[model samples]
Target chain A: MEVLAHGLGGRTDLPLDAVAAIVGGGAAVAASFLALTVAWRRPRLRPEGGRPVPARIARALDSPALTWAGRTVALAAAVFVVVVALAGPGGEKANLAPWALYVTFWVGLVPASVLLGPVWRRVNPLRTLHDGLCRITRADPAGRWPIPKRLGYWPAAAWLTGFVWLELVAPHRSDPRLVGVLIIAYGAVNLALARVCGRDWFTRGDGFEAYSNLLARMCPVGRRGDGTLVLRTPLTGLMRVTGEPGLVAAACVLIGSTGFDGITRTTYWRDNVDPGSLSAGTLGLAAAIGVVTVLYLAGMRVSAALTGEAAGELPGRFAATLLPIALGYTVAHYFSFFVLEGQMTFILASDPFGTGLNLLGSTGHRIDYDLAGPTLTAQVQVNAIVLGHIAATIAAHDLALRTQPAHRTVRGQLPIAVVMVALTCAGLFALLSG
Target chain B: MRGVRLRTVVMAVAIGVAVTLAGCGEPAAPSGGTGGSGGTSGTGTAKSAPATFTGPSRKPDVTVVSATVSRGKVEIAQNGVNAQGRVKVRRGATVRITVTTDEADEFHLHGYDRTLKLSPGRPGTLDVVADKTGVFEAELHHSGARVFELQVS
Candidate 1:
């Protein structure tokens, strides 16, 4: 049904899943292209008007929408709690899966929080309250980061670890209510911790801002202050703070400990029902998350290093070597999902729950992909997900490198990318058919 | 600035209109039961299934087509036409039951056992006999409220 919906032949019904995969996959590649291009061109391609721009600290103080969204989510959690209470333990009538909610929230954050600034600043209650507190106390909340810079990577690590524990270890992967409870609890805890970390967590040093700035060097730095965008390069060195990174380390420690505590306490209950029977599968998922995170971090590191080099040169001289590895990982992980979870293969297509396959848009303009058939899965493996990501990253770097040398356009590399995409699709077709 | 506001307002209006339209269209409710409770087992036969299991009724969208208890076998046929349906058994040891649905729905016998997804136009069955007996509800799930009742000894 999923394959038919995302039919091989292009009809009016249009395979939403396939189109989504292409567009989404394509966009990620495009971002990589922008990054690479910036690197290749070096310092010269830096936007004409915006260079050596003095850091504007005022805008940084303004809250991001993400923070507001988090608060709003926390508010709505009231509804979930009410439902759970009324529904009771034996009340399995309603289908509410919290795991799905967690996936959606984090997935949304990845591109925004990681690739861009938190964007939640405008709506962030914590920031607003922190600023107010600072004003009332007449203290410098911006001087020292509450947390340490070294502890910056812990959130992502914690996120990865949490997924491992919930999906793999604590069992009840199939239980919607349990999953929902976990998400609510996690959110509540994060919010509470953020309150303790205070405003200094962001303003103290380069922290997330630094990582974002490094990410910016990879792509054509978009016009800043042209109105907020879902995507923006992080401000550089926002993460680097001098004094005690204690508060930050404490936050990480708290998160990690809680995750472990949740596992230990829940393990007994899980063992009784024991859904995630295959310990190997659990390990594989953990490994996959680690691999993806490392690959992503590595890609960023390479982009950063290349940016440091002289202008008008190829960015990341060695980035191309990692493309195949990243691509291979994408294929392996996605295929693993298909092999392990028989039901989730066509998840993008069918909303057995009435969600529908047209996630991004209406029927004619959907952007999802059909993972129903081997052919489609192969297409995703080679062309869209894996190879596509590599192409984009490489393309971005190349563009950055070639941005200099007025005569030499990165346009030449476009052909290579096209060829690679075609080759990937062809390879996928062959593999899937075979 | 005008363009941004306009876009936001337009998007909001569009969403509102879509939502309103969605609300207007009524979901296929359990009109009533068509078949008898048990023509095969010589029990009572039902003609007109409830036309609509209206507001907060005990049998809201509920239907129990058949129920039987023989020497060591208990059989029950149910249509997930309503939100909640009930089944009463006389005496059976190892019970085997079958459930069929007219459209795509779920058949979950609450308290007795787990639920299974029933494909459209296809029937799904769950079979379990009593070892420990306390009255339990054989409930069918609708959207909001689930209609069910006590399975008396």
Candidate 2:
């Protein structure tokens, strides 16, 4: 019982349920932090523009397998496919929180361009679309496109908006027929925009360019080779930009999570209620877009920080220092849901579908399969998730610091990470135990 | 560096405060108002407190709207009623209920203190008994008005 109360195991009140939540919860935290850190700050020591370059653009474009346009369209198409598949009729519900699916996307996109060393120019979606559409319609897709210095990038913004709409607005409509119409209407909007801007505008935006450029700054200062990078911005500006965005992203995450939860509630339960059919899911979708935009803005801020100058404006500096704030947001947002839905375990265990999703599963006969029952190992799985992310962040931060002198290590940062992780674990354990 | 450390300390303290505040919303003491306690109503004995029921009844009009071995689950269409001639209750008979509302309304049995208010088209159920035995009203309410009713004995 003491272990149940203070340990990662959720609660002694409900023995079976606590087990799953503890392990899984712990692991999720650890994995997310670690993955983000490792992926962001790992040093491959690649040489920057030091290699003798063939002076031809043609030489750069001469990869046999994929033209730049081909790759951009392919990536976009892949994203589209995954989104549709996951949110589609029979697809799993979109619960990509501290979990793998969400982490995977972050991991893939973050390190992809940097690890591969600035392929953004080639895979620029705008350029790809311009080329692809031209070939498809046999029309000239290329013109001297003006790069607007003030214009915020649109690819992530648009994608984020579309996702919000799906989650909030479209999901709530009770009439399947109306939902189909709205989807078609949304597709039309995308098509029209693609037609007007020529696919390149959407694909080859300044966002990824900005990202890659920022990453380049973090490379070795004067190490002129295949493995060096340079930092260049004012520390104050970098700090201001990086700090706000991360916090904003954390806020967005909370909003997004809540919005999705609301949408799910309304669509599956509330809308189906006898009198509330007048509501539409569009409002929720709009809210989701807002949340996602905040996330994007935050992401851009991180990119901006990487580009910012000063040796102290390094990855480890942020990782070791600012990680607690980030982790704090994570705990607040996720725990909100945990508090709301955690009791579902008890409800479902006693009588599956005592409320909500259970009604749909009723088969006259009481089936033995109960999803609400949390086994002992399930606790481990949950905790493992939390633990994994923290560990990953620490490892990543440590690795980034390796690029600098050991004496210069901001030792204070390590304690911050440990304290945050420990506090979170302890609190979570209390919740489970209680 | 010390100043930065101080800021970190302040932030940590802030987080701790927020978490403590959040913890206040944890589940309250379990009230033990669980569903499914059943007993038969004594005929004509109107109790002051809310009525509850268990066991079977071979009566008409008073129906158990659920699917269970105790009470054969019968379908009641929108704005329609089931044939109310006979009802048989089981021991420890929880009147397993399955109600699907096509609109927002409250399903309240006038004789029972319990009432279930559901959203439009949402389905929900609760277990209570016809504890008191007398003429009673099963009322469906909407926006604070009684929309429909069923007679119970």
Candidate 3:
């Protein structure tokens, strides 16, 4: 009955009655599917159509001065984190590097991107540095050779998988020096790739950039290809996601990583899985990803066969539907971790070097656990998971209508809808059973 | 208007489901309240309740239980027989755990927040009184490998 330490939020006694949460989640998704099938006939989300933002507001947001300022701030913060990580005390208590990477940057990026629309792309320090180096050398930043079109987002997917493995499976992930070294290594590799691939490399190659850009598609406020700031429905923005190469793999990685995170904390995993073997943990992580991929691909195949569409085209066609589900799992798994340990970033910012100098006067601040008690945490987790499933169902239904003939739409989506329900149940079980 | 109505219906359904789920679980109660007191009563009376000790001792004089934790297994001796399970101690009992691991790790006892650094082949010992009656996780800090649960009751 030992409450295992899963993530940043210590000992989460989520007061969710497992049966009720799972049942409610499954029912909610099923109800949403029925509602969509009955009421929704045409594809409502139009990616190309949006109301233009006011001239004054759009001008300010797109200003060169604002972009430079954001880049400067991001670069300065990156430098500060590196300094502290290298020079500061190594433990989680004294070091801010781990908290910054895991809780703040990794988890915080989700809400930030969803609200602000690809904030990381605008403020990415590595991109700025690469551009600066290109300027100094009087050379093209996009490198002499072009990145092949077929490469697509595969590199981003691979790198994302590697990053998650480091976070969830690596033995010394919490060590500040190790985190710092990884950050430096990641930046070096990406910057070198950026020089050859040009600035477009970040759009599809950088893992964090790809992650931010994908989430940003759901943001209501987004700039069109012509740099016109427009306000659209969130679903409209989500419709803009293209099914590029490895998009399915990327989505599965997101879903499966979160799945592993939840399952690893359960009594079932603890009692059954070998704790001391790295191979066991790796297998568990891979199996979770494999299960999600297989289930999603199977659903898409059934839908494709019914609709008379190519099976190869179905993955990317239905990839956008997974975003909400991924976002849901991210929110459910990291909500408390972000709220509680996110504060540590600010506290550690005050004393980055673990020296007594209180730079930000936040060194003495304590995290308020009452902000998310067990009851409130459980409610949010359940609601977020269920709502996410509902959103996914709607997104999939809309896509199915747009892709398939009107006569085949409902029948084609039936299997996928069932898959969504099952995934919702699995998600709820992970959150509650843990 | 149709979109708005559909959104409203979805919202209503979500709220209804949330309410139903919330109603299924009991409200959160203070940790170690009646449960801890009851467990103390069930166990034999304390021979001597130390005046200064109201909580788990930072340092305690106790029998050191030797355990070996590898990548996936926790090996401990029980009654001269090797067994794999959580460490159990009575409430108010002073307890010490000496652990050896195949890899370097920061050994952490969660509820107590006591930490020990264990290196490969090198054993580390942690001592604390079982002042609280509850199940607490003991794990490797970075790797997140659970060594065992310390069930004190």
Please tell me how candidate 2 rates in CAPRI terms. incorrect
Give the residue spans of candidate 3 off by over 4 A. Answer: A1-15, A240-242, A364-366, B1-107, B115-136, B140-153
- For candidate 2, what is the DockQ? 0.03
Tens digits of per-residue lDDT for model 3, A3-119? 233333233434256788899889988988998989989998777778999999999998999999999999998888887888898776678888788877888788778767899
lDDT of 1 by residue, A1-434 (tens): 00000001111110123344445444545555555555545422222233333344324434455455666674454354434423423221223233223222222222233223344433333355456566787766553436656565445335545553553345344355665566556545544454556554533222222222222222212334443222222221111112222222222222222222223222232224222244643554444344333433344344344344342122233223223322232232233122212222123212223334433232122112122233333343434233433533343333334342443335544433443343233223222211
Go through the candidates in order and give each one's DockQ. Answer: 0.03, 0.03, 0.07
| Chain A accuracy as TM-score for every candidate | 0.43, 0.38, 0.96
Q: Rank the candidates by lDDT, best first.
A: 3, 2, 1
Q: Is candidate 1 or candidate 3 better by lDDT?
A: 3
- Model 2: per-residue Cα lDDT at residue B88: 29
Question: Against the true structure, what is each candidate's TM-score?
Answer: 0.39, 0.36, 0.80
Interface RMSD for model 3 amounts to 10.8
On the 0 to 100 scale, the lDDT of residue B36 in model 1 is: 16
Q: Which of the numbered candidates is closest to the native, going by highest DockQ?
A: 3
Interface RMSD after interface superposition, each candidate = 20.6, 20.4, 10.8
| Candidate numbers sorted by TM-score from highest down | 3, 1, 2
DockQ of 1: 0.03
- CAPRI tier of model 1: incorrect
- On DockQ, the stronger of 2 and 3 is 3
lDDT of 1 at A172: 40
Please state every model's RMSD to the true fold in angstroms. Answer: 16.0, 17.4, 7.8
